[model samples]
Target: MSGSFSLFIVGWGIIMIVLLAIGGFFMFRKFLKRLPKEDGKSILDWEEHYLELTRHMWGEDEKQFLEELVSPVPELFRDIARQKIASKIGEVALNKKQKQITRDTIIEGYIIATPKRDHKFLIKTLKEKNIDLRPYQSLFEQA
Candidate 1:
């Protein structure tokens, strides 16, 4: 009976060690992914730069609109999704050297940043808002 109990404890210890190793591996991988690239910019740095570039252009109304646009995302992920979409929109605005954030910029940025699977939600939302999508049809097709 003592030997059986000892074996059970050893087995449990082995399992716990394996689980910890797996967890540690994933944590290390995430750390690597956040490291700066050749451009000397990490993902977080790029996001911050984009946000700063377009900060002056975001009015309360535009903020509200962006929140509404990302409402379809699950509650837990909505904030991250919103940030990514906003960053992308800012990048788009910067690329176009726009003086202000236009509706087209918002839409284009949202479409570009989101995965193809989420395009269906975007299309439905745009339709509900009566926003014409002819301009982005090709982009949607490519996605």
Candidate 2:
């Protein structure tokens, strides 16, 4: 009976440890998500910077198109992902001194902003939507 009780206690302890580990994992992810960038800019600051840089160039139609392009992102991260993509796009447009955002501009920005690990998903999404990969082959190779 004593041996059985000890085993039960051990099992409970292991379960508790696993539960704590799972909780910690989620907490750590939340903490990382809110962590400031190396340059001391908050996520909101970056978002605003991109928006300010590109606002004048974005028409209603282009804004709507961007939203549609980002629709595949999971709901929880969609806004942040959209902001990051837009930031890249804005940066590219600013560098080129482009007067407006074109489809190619959006595609190039999307490729540059997305991580290499996610390029497969990006390619799949683009293909499903009938976007050609030929124009952006170099971007994928570089990534």
Candidate 3:
């Protein structure tokens, strides 16, 4: 009877361990989904490679466009803009063209949603995202 009881206890322990492992596996998967991933290449990986290049190419004074457009309320505008970018980036950030489209959409939304813009941060972020502004000169000028 005692041997049977011990076996039952071990069996229960094994089941509990298996259940815990399964739960942990699912939780880890959920956590991983929140981070950027591109077939093992992540946004972080891209930024790590490009940050230096961008810093060397763009100057602090290059924010003239965003400064004028988002000058009124910077914090709020940035938060909203980042949210927009975050949402779109997940779908389109795998390639340069798609990433550019995501950046453009986020900036366009920023222009529309900004109560008052913070050109400094806006331009900084645009540079961070490597946005190409050649086609949007008119939009920038309007701000």
Candidate with best TM-score: 1
What is each predicted model's overall lDDT from 0 to 1?
0.88, 0.86, 0.51
RMSD of each: 4.0, 3.9, 13.7
- lDDT digits (tens) for residues 62-133 of candidate 2: 788778778999998898789889988888888889999888888898999899999988989889879989
Q: If both were scored by lDDT, which would come out higher, candidate 1 or candidate 2?
A: 1
Model 1 lDDT-worst window of ten: 25-34
Evaluated with lDDT, which candidate comes out highest? 1
Instruction: List the candidates' TM-scores in order.
Output: 0.75, 0.71, 0.28
Tens digits of per-residue lDDT, candidate 3, 27-125, equal: 786466457776665544444444333333323443344343344445745544444333333332333343232335446645433333555565565
Q: How many clashes in candidate 1?
A: 0
1-143 in candidate 1: lDDT tens per residue?
99999999999999999999999997897677579999998886788799988999887878888888999889977987898899999999999999888888899998898899878888999898899999999879876
What residue runs in model 2 are displaced by over 4 Å at the alpha carbon? 1-47
Better of 2 and 3 by lDDT: 2
Candidate 3: regions farther than 4 A off = 1-103, 115-117
Higher-scoring candidate on TM-score, 1 or 2 = 1
Q: CA lDDT of 52 in candidate 2?
A: 91
